[model samples]
Target: MNIQTVGVIGAGVMGIGVAQNLAQTDHQVILIDISEDILDKAKYEIRNNIRLQSFFQKSDNRKTPDSILEKIDFSTSYKLLENADFVVENVTEKWDIKKGIYPQLDAICPQHCVFAANTSAIPITRLASLTKRPDQVLGIHFMNPVPMKPMVEMIRGYHTSETTIEIAKQMLSQMGKECVIVNDSPGFVSNRVLMLTINEAVFLLQDQVATAEDVDKIFKGCFGHKMGPLETADLIGLDTILFSIEVLYENFNDSKYRPCPLLKKMVDAGLYGRKNGQGFFVYQ
Candidate 1:
């Protein structure tokens, strides 16, 4: 289906970015957050993402970013989502919370509106089953820093229809993202492999094999990696990194996929990479 209006549930980092991108493409975007405070914060984030792309950077293009920001309609009310042609649910990683929104989305959205989850690792099939229109539900996983990231991982669940998959690709491509299709699995591909590498880096730090900075340096210095695991985990959110590692471990039952204690402690303490001002390096 041709997507003219987009509904975004949750106005967190990922949600706003998704809204911003769609809005830039001139799609009327409804960005919903349950709490007014969270919705307010998301509005701030969307503005920043737009400013950085439009005016802050010397090398960045300005046109599309401003237009994208202009197209968004931020709200705390779920009723605003009714007219959307596509719904991009980007709530927190908790399964129950994500599951709760789908049925509600199903009730409100147009019967043919595409349901796309911006989930990083959860099996889409489980989430899809909760909705009435399972055939149209699919995963459209955008990487972190959505405005800057170029890739969008399109994950198809066990029962995802061919039409849903095609529409997902078309929507993301229309917004200028590189869409790669992957089966519903833990961490899909890039994140799964990257999690292992990051977990190993964490292991080295915990085992006293290297300092966090050096752990990052070794990979960048010798392994041709531009961003090391710890640095990456920080940017990806230590909470997200830990959760992805856990999912990978649980899915594979592999010792190597186990998350580091340091990772857990940081997340538990609420230090989420750049967002928290501390993960590996100080952000501020």
Candidate 2:
């Protein structure tokens, strides 16, 4: 099915990026959140992001930021999603919050609407089980900066059909992204390893192995990585990193996945990384 109108749940960092990217592709976007205040903040951020992105990438499509923003409808009501052809849910990674959303989305969206869970560590199969249309639910893990990223990690739940996979691929194609399809698992391929690395990085910092700057420098200067694991954790949000690692620990019942105490302390301190201007390293 052709997905022209898309519903985006949550107004957080990932959700705003997804909505912005969809609007740039000329898709009508229904961006839903729990409150008007959050939606209002999301609108402001999307507008700013569009302007900033224009400075970095030149595109043949000359739609101005205002015109792109016009394509998105920010609302607090789930009822507004009734006509959405596709829905990508980017809510918090916690299972309790997500389990409460999928069933509601199933009730509101069209039967053909595919639900894409843009999550970090939660198992797609577990999420799919909450909805009656398990075959239509899959995972589309869009990278941090949705518009700038060229690839996504797509998770195929045990019940997700091939047709659903094709539809997801088609939607990603429209957004100028390619997908690497992988089997459903807690953390999948990317976060399964990434969370461990970030947790270890935190442990290193707690152990005084090196400064955050030097640690990131080694990965960038010596390992040829764009950013070190600590920097990545900061970008992903320290709280988010901690939650993902905890999920992995519980799911695998392993000590290695245990979160560093310092990571937990920082999260408790409300230093959520770039979003809040503080984390492993403070942002300007």
Best by TM-score: 2
lDDT of each: 0.82, 0.92
Q: Mind giving the per-residue lDDT tens digits that candidate 2 earns over 152-271?
A: 999999999999999999999999999999999999999998898888888889999999999899989998999899888888888878888888988999898989999999999999
Candidate 1 per-residue lDDT, tens place, 119-235, comes to 767788888999888888888888877867888889888889998888887888878888888898877887778888888887788899889999988889998988888888888
TM-scores, all models, native as reference: 0.92, 0.98
Clash number by candidate, in order: 2, 0
Collision pairs in model 1: 23-68, 24-68
- What is residue 164's positional error in candidate 2, in angstroms? 0.1
